[model samples]
Target: MRVRRCRESDVTTQIDAHQHYWDPARDDYGWLTPDLAALYRRFGPADLAPLRERAGVSRTVVVQAAATVDETRYLLALARDEASIAGVVGWVPMLLPDTPALIGELAAQPKFKGVRPMLQDLPDDNWIANPELAPAVDALIAHDLTFDALIFARHVAPLEIFATRFPKLRIVVDHGAKPSVRDGAAGWQPWADGIERLARLPNVHCKVSGLATEASHDWTEATLQPYVAHLLASFGAGRLMWGSDWPVLNLNGDYLQWHAVASELLGALPDAQRDAIFGANAAAFYRL
Candidate 1:
């Protein structure tokens, strides 16, 4: 990312804990094929420089966009030196029995704040709610690790059950349970209700990020309002957080667009509430 001169106050000391970074040349984003390249456009660390500079957000938590352990360590290394990247939510095989010991090993690294699994893409008949995996999911709470939930509409119901099973785990729901911006309000109530139910779990939180991308290829704040509003209402400021989801969001919107739309939707809140949603909540919850 390009770093320009900025006054001390312009540099936010708080966290912007959900941006993504990928070095295309280092390794191909196997999941994002050439066809998908058009969606991402010109995106990477460089694209976010001005957003950070303008927003005065110094620290951010980088999370896994692709499900892989290497992506986690890759970001952890960045957090080691880049003061702005204060935390990381990397991916791990949480379903495996050995996952707990592995997470314990990574927990030693201060920047490794959480882990995520892209559960939404799984087959409709998948078994994420199995009792066997409960132990590994529970291990995250024991280690004070934040578990970022990236699932789909149908997955929300099961997620609610999962939250009830682990009321103490710090679970951050990314993309507001990933509603379809293209889908009308009628198609999303089930997901919204499911998320609301999960928000009842004290340890659960919601991240206001990646909405522009989740919308249809063509989207506007109006298309995203219902989801964002519902999430804010359910989780409230205390349990809410904001993220750019950077490079990934390039699939549909840029940093400035994401920030501006969020500003319009969330501008009505008090400064304290804004601070909590934008950064403080994440800092307090993840202990960053």
Candidate 2:
């Protein structure tokens, strides 16, 4: 892991709400192709510990990168040994009949806090909004587990429908629905509008992560400022959370760079609000 000295902040309990730990040699990560050379190898807690420690991040919510229950179990096993993992947002076959029982078993694990369906990779933008998946979604609510919506801008509307349909399900929009940062200011319309609409739903939340990858190769903090500002305006500090999106983040930048950029972008906020975005909100949202 690469380390950079970052200026300390007032955040006492920093939690990276969206990150991953995977070993392609052991698991089937369909997306882990050789083309993504920078991320084709193993990435585990040992590699992340020093980076997070250097950035003053004490805990993390390790989310699912593969669309398999085995991958979820792999993360759960990792969390068992890695104390810094506050929770594991594992995967469940939501469209299958046995989802409820499977969820019951996973939720019994103390660190299993939620589920993510890899929505962005699916062919149907409205896949998550399917009424047939209600049983699985209900099971999440029954177990007090969160639902991490891994989506893109195109899926925002369907996500709104899903959120409204399951008002009690605590849903956090990973990567602010992945706005079109590469399009620059011109790409703000539908994405911004969609995010604002999702914010109106009390149960919906967003993450201040992954924007660096969404922007151009030479992206700077100024390139991300407007999007961050829009997120703050839409969700406020209470509903937003900070994350590293590490390993994948390595494609664009390192953990320290993202953390520093986030701190700089949010520097103007009062310490209390900044604290919430950095840690408290994730603690509350994931019940960590």
Candidate 3:
């Protein structure tokens, strides 16, 4: 990746806050079905190297796309080997009795920064807030591991409850809380409201990622600006961070295309503030 030093004091380095790598042949990602043929094949560090370079991303946090602990282990191994991957957001069996042990084992590894439950796939929207999972959540807090909320807007209310229940636990809402951006203004309010409520918690952060894929086949900077603006207003640059959402982003837009769009959306902000959104906030949040 091309390195450009920013002169502004608050402006520092650029990091891709969120991205993923998957080996379908090695791991069973049920979501990686043939219907999504474009992403069905292997996506490793080499596959993402060019995209990161094209987008000028200096480092990245590789997140889990599968629910298995084995997948998390795979990512952790990659983080150890790949220079560009600064952190790994691995998965945990949230409902299992032995979750704390799983977290402890993974947390022993240097680059295992956080854990994410596939909340959107679970039938119960209230799962995160369930008291039965308190030990697991507490284990994450104890280990200083972040909780990556891989959820849809419907899961946001429960997420707020979870955040409130554990105030000091670091939480980041992945993919702008993944609103249905194709809905335009009429369908945007629920996600906007949820994000606003979640941001009220000092400990919660939001990712300005994955918007392009939520829209229909034809999405543009204009189509995504309103949602981006809402996140800026809700989270502020200090609490917000940028992510390519990469291979998934390929579903709607290329890596550089999304990067350019994100830059355009934040054009009004001062360079320092934009730097926080693009890089600093994530570095601080994930301890990269």
CA RMSD per model (angstroms): 3.8, 1.9, 2.7
In the range 2-94, model 1's lDDT, one tens digit per residue, is 223223432235457688877655453557656777543434455566788686676788877667788778778867877677788888887
lDDT of 2 at 92: 89
Which digits, one per residue and each the tens of the lDDT, describe model 3 over residues 1-288?
A: 122323335346789999999988975698888799788888999998886776667799998999888898889888888999999998888768888988898889989999888788889898888978888888999998898898887887888889999998999999998998888777787787888889899999999999998998788888999899999999898999999898998888888888878877787798878899989899899988
Best by TM-score: 2
Clashing pairs in 3: none
**lDDT (Cα, tens digit) per residue for candidate 2, span 75-150:** 9999999899999999988989999999999999999999999899999989987999999999999999999998
- Please report, as a residue range, the 10-residue window in candidate 2 with the lowest summed lDDT: 1-10
TM-score of 1: 0.88
lDDT of 1 at 224: 81
Using lDDT as the yardstick, the better of models 1 and 2 is 2
lDDT of each: 0.75, 0.91, 0.86
Once superposed on the true structure, which residue ranges of model 2 sit more than 4 Å away at CA?
1-9
lDDT of 2: 0.91
- Each candidate structure's count of clashing pairs: 2, 0, 0
Q: Look at candidate 1 and tell me the lDDT of residue 25.
A: 52
